[model samples]
Target: MSRSLKFALLITLRGFSWYIRHVTKSFLGRGQVPVIDSDAHVVETERTWEFIDGNDIRFKPVLASARSEPNNYRWLVDDKLRRRAMLSDIDHLRPVDRNTQTPEDAREMSDIQSRLNHMDQLGIDVQVLHNTLFIEQVADRIEVDVAVCKAWNRWLADIWSKGNGRFRWSCVLPLTSINDALDQMRFAKDNGAVAVCMRPIESTRTLPDIYFYPIYEEAERLNMAIAVHIANGNSAVCDVLRSPYDPGASFGMFRAMTAVSCHSYMVSELPQKFPLLRWGFIEASAQWGPWVAHEARRRYEASGKVFPDNPFAEFRVYVTCQNDDDLDYIVGYVGEDNLLIGTDYGHFDPSSEIDAISILKSRTDLSTSLINKIVDFNPRNFYAI
Candidate 1:
């Protein structure tokens, strides 16, 4: 066949296959492609800290309600306010239903079956839960950090036991202490965790800093991907960058920091150093990727370094894209294998597209093979599921 005829035939075959699958799923309810919700979240409750043991019990985060902000509940950790417990139910703009609209049991994973049923309704096969609390700085004190992370991991492990392999999670580590972080990573790997969650801007150290070398090494050794979620660990930077008028920092600054981390990691030789390790820039839309790659190349040349033509592929790096992102444009930079998609399930943010799977499937602009990779193949391989 001629090249043009071959391409036309490929498109026709894919369209026919999609039509068959759609009809079967609509009528028989069994032909839909199983989807992995790669960026789901679980709301941390008072019970999330119940696993804290021994003297560490003193460091258990206390849930407190703000009198000034009656709608906000937060965690007081090491005498400092941690991230808000949850988005306010009465917030006018975002609204409570954005995140907590799900049944309380399902939102908190207190009832595993409830969450599973909710996922079933959404057509999600598995949900890789990320931490809502640890997305920001937890505590300045290493002891407190260790206590909360350990408890959180233990709590997730228990939840995973009840989830029947439908729930996977990324483990949080005490970045202040490398030895302790390694210990926690080992435990998490054994207990159904497929990745280690780290903030993109972790305090004074960035992802390429020597401080994270041990983490990258251990993550590679354990076959766990380093999940650089859209978060800032430095409260000072967040305060300075987040404007008074801005409703939230996550929408703007945190995502920029994550893109910066992606650029830094790609420009630097970190990925090459930890070749076996997979790096995922989660919840940061893949829109900035090509820009970062273009900028990374400029920086590489400025420093007399040769940039890889496809850094995302050359390095084992992946990025989670939003439904609104220019998929055709981003796919050109990231290639099909390095691009993944998620619902940002459980959070009401700009990245949250509760129907991301269906949304991607509906985009006829993208080839069916590419859509399958974003919704299934890429995420499964990235998370090592």
Candidate 2:
């Protein structure tokens, strides 16, 4: 046999093996519910800003690294350095393993097919990609914000087009400029974004502030969920909460803010105001659901109002749960239908659970139906995935 023939045969066998594995995993479990990773992340790469418009080229974000420390990277945006430029920047947490089961190109999503293959391995039928850069404020200037957000949305849209419906995203907007934000939301909705990303505390405004009402109104009109991912747009708050020695203490700022957002929204009746819109409190585990619900109930009573038996259901709100969370208790406040789960794919924080779907399934405390809702039905209903 010729050496060239042997090489071709080897390639053929590898391709055939991949096909068999993919088909067996996808179709063999026809009766089983498909898993949707509600909060997977896409680590930002230099390629992310390539979609910036010609006129906005001046506002393009520049990736910079120190000469002495090769891995000390940050994004230079509007003459400022954003330390958390990429998931890998937080090396203390060991954010992501680029060359592990997932390839670097796949994790950053420069190669969409490779990412899909990794998803297949993880049993994630669809991954709702979130932005790593936009977790914190990318730019203080409105022009920069608008330009950068437009570019990011366009980049995600292109990825979605090539993903074969396996990648949905949460779109970020220039909240400072409501008009530009609305336009971006429309573009995102027309493309493949299932939700709009918001922080619990966005700059000087909180989620319940009327400043965000316009964004909420537009999101509802687009039939998109307001996904309040664990983020701190307020730099002052971040500074106060950040601990030099403890990464968990620093990261707790984001989790606490998201929980506060949920509580604030419930008390403010923001969800009721936007009746048609769905609200998602993600990454921050659902254990806080009962606490927030209880606090909201007390605030309602104090204000001479009657709190509903299930605020989450009444408000069209959903929250993500971790495998370690007490779902049996959280369910009593959040209700089964309003609970979802996620794998914080690219980041290695406390919430990061690459095998969350399988782990949740193994919980003997939860019934099969409830587990299915957390992994499948709830996420599909929340993000319309």
Q: Give every collision pair in model 1.
A: none
Cα lDDT tens digits, model 2, 1-385, are: 7542353344346434533443336654577667788989888777988999999999998877778866777888999878556533454546463212346678788888888888888888878899888778788899999999999999999999998767889999999899999999999999989999998889998988888888988887676889999999988878877878875764567888899888888888676687677889989888999999999999999999988999898787899988888877888888998898888887776778788887788878789999877776677777765
**Positional deviation of residue 361's Cα in model 1 after best superposition, in angstroms:** 1.8
- Model 2, C-alpha of 86: deviation from truth (Å): 3.7
Worst 10 residues of 1 by lDDT: 19-28
How does model 1 score by TM-score? Answer: 0.88
TM-scores, all candidates, are 0.88, 0.88
Predicted structure 2: lDDT: 0.82
Model 1 bad stretches (over 4 Å): 1-32, 87-100
lDDT, candidates in the order shown: 0.81, 0.82
CA deviation > 4 Å runs, candidate 2: 1-29, 66-68, 87-92, 95-101, 245-247
